[model samples]
Target: MIRTATPDDVPLIHAMVRDLAEYEKALDEARATEEQLREALFGERPAAFGHIAQDDDSGEVVGFALWFLNFSTWRGVHGIYLEDLYVRPEARGGGHGKALLRELARICVERGYERLEWSVLDWNEPSINFYKSLGALPQDEWTVYRLTDGALAGLGAAVE
Candidate 1:
């Protein structure tokens, strides 16, 4: 079963995030703390939302998806930017990942959104294949860029 996550699931979310980072070989870069997650996910104006997949028989969480809304100026519609989607290794082949994504897609369709999107590491062939099988196309024409930590601070200072 898949359901919206509650504040009580913060620890589970954080742990899964760490697990995802490790799987992507970037565990050292995962800096999310439980307090930060709580604030971001359940703050006055929540920045993101989370959903968890549970084993019906055992009532154990098997997967999770974190996402946020983004505006597509060109499309003139809101889109869901999935930040993380992880299914425990033991839960592979159980359709949990696809079910999570299907739920997000349903949300977009029901809300009249333009698209559902997310990024995957270039090296994650398994995930890439899965997405392709689902008819998700990569935007090879676009490149993603980021500025964080010191670089972000530098940019802020430059603006002043």
Candidate 2:
């Protein structure tokens, strides 16, 4: 079963995020604190949303999908930008990951959103195959760039 996350799921969500980072070989970069996740997911004005997938027999939370809304000016509609999607190693192969993605797709269709999109690491062949099985095609023509930390601060200080 998949359902919306609550305040109580914050700790589990944090742990899962760390587990995902470790799997991605970037544990050191997973610096988000539980408080930060709490504020982001359950704050008075939430910036993101999360969904939990539970084991049918044991009713234990096994996976999650954390996402936020982004605007596409060309489409003029808000689309979900999935930040992370994970299922415990032992819990994988159970269709939980696909179910979580299906829930997001359902939300987009219901809201009249033009697209459902997320990024997968190129080296993760398993994930790439899974996404492809779902009919998710890669936007190979575009490159993603970001400014962070010192660069971001320096730009903010620059005079227009």
Per-model TM values vs. the true structure = 0.97, 0.97
Return the TM-score for candidate 1, rounded to 2 decimals. 0.97
Worst 10 residues of 1 by lDDT: 151-160
* lDDT of all predictions: 0.95, 0.95
lDDT measured at residue 157 in model 2 versus the true structure, 0 to 100: 98
Model 1 C-alpha lDDT per residue in residues 18-134, reported as the tens digit of each score: 999999888999998999999999999999999999988899999999999999999999999999999999998899999999999999999999999999888899999999999
Alpha-carbon deviation at 130 in model 1, angstroms: 0.4
TM-score of 2: 0.97
